[model samples]
Target: MSRRKVGLWYRLAAALTRPPMMMLFRRDWRGRHHIPATGGFMVVVNHNSSLDPVAYGHYQYSTGRVPRFLAKSSLFTNGAVGAMLRRTGQIPVPRGTKDVRDALKAAVSAVNGGEGVVFYPEGTLTRDPDLWPMAGRTGAARVALRTRCPVIPVAQWGAHRVLPPYQKKPRIFPRTTHQVLAGPALDLSSYYGRAVTPALLGEVTDVFMGAITDLLAEIRGEPAPAIRQRTGREHPHGLPSVSGRS
Candidate 1:
């Protein structure tokens, strides 16, 4: 399918999905104005629960932007779900591989076509049980560098509290409240047009992760675990640095 058709289908799906989602979470989104009214961009948000994408999707739809999410291939198993994802312009990524050339090309094309792409740099929901963002991976950085699009850091809290991770069921009697905060866009011009060295990539990833951590802290009313302090190194994946950097 063409990008135009995919985006149209995504918009329709989002419209249909948003209303019930709003009712389910009784969502209260703030700083939505921070999202640009028009343009290509990437939204890098912290992951806490499986519902994070749904919450963010609803929020993006409310802001008049149809979101294209990068999801794991496992979630696309169901025929209906896979069809919906395809119609909605979501990309499925194969895990545990460096072979993202195809996914990267698709992402770059989407951004260049003026679509909004949302991804979780952590790659999985937070395992800390407190829902704080874990150290980030570098996939988001690579995309950001490739597209040179504005990267908006979104901090989401209370979703995990709504439906905690590793639980088999969710509580539906009393709807949970969710808060979505959209922060300012990150600047990556310093490394643009240059070879993305390990140090440069780590620096860019830290910049994005720091913003996400700050937003999580704001929502939870407590500081998130410091990345450098806890791990003693940048980035969870430990991507090696090239010569003369890091």
Candidate 2:
């Protein structure tokens, strides 16, 4: 598989961040072959830790693909930081506003343009007490179905130990392992060209999230709960409600 083109910003960011990440954690990653060697695709992942994006990006980067992540809009408010994010191909999402459509449209555009787009299907940290994936929003589904692109399901664990949800500081004393598994692209061809409706979107969301939960279960070696815990209201971009969480 040919490597995707890497921009200067992404290259610089990786050079600065990769070494510390390597120093702080060990990796138990698998299923690299599941990521398409060439073409646009969406990576739907389970969100547990704030640090998992770096962890997951490392895994994908190792596969020679640069991933464009949907990040909170506030992160892009800083002038220099925002410029770097835009250059690095990160999509800014404004949660709870009508502007979310812009984010979703950008995601679809990214995929159609032969880039890898990463979506945290839960939109926020797992509200589940056990750190299992909560109910997913339909933003990813909307994009996937809209583009008819391959949606790869990935699951990651252990980054939460380093930086638990909503924590300001990380505990990196003992190096931890970030375990990630990438499953094959989901088979959503049957739903191609179907009318987009709420019920259809919900059904599609379940299919994608179910694939991610199953992969996490494989990583954890445990059965997932039949019912995922509901967190809050969802946006078109799959973000949790903006009242409390980012």
Q: What is the C-alpha lDDT of each candidate?
A: 0.75, 0.86
lDDT of 1 by residue, 1-246 (tens): 122333567767766777767677876688888777777889999876777688888888778777889998777777877788877778888876765667777888888888888989877766553456677778889999998988999998666655665454765657777888899898788889888888888878888889988987777677666552232234353422221110
lDDT of 2 by residue, 1-246 (tens): 223499788999889779988988898989999998889999999987788888888889888889899999998988887787888989999999999999999998888888899999888888776778888999999999999988999999888878886676988878888899999889998888888999899999999889999999999888988999886643334433323211
State which candidate has the highest lDDT: 2
Candidate 1 regions with alpha-carbon error over 4 angstroms: 1-8, 228-246
Per model, state how many residue pairs clash: 0, 0
lDDT of 2 at 117: 93
lDDT of 2: 0.86
Which window of 10 residues has the lowest lDDT sum in candidate 2?
237-246
Tell how far residue 62 is off in model 1, in angstroms: 0.6
TM-score of each: 0.85, 0.91
Clashing pairs in 1: none
Candidate 2, superposed: residue stretches over 4 Å from native: 1-4, 233-246
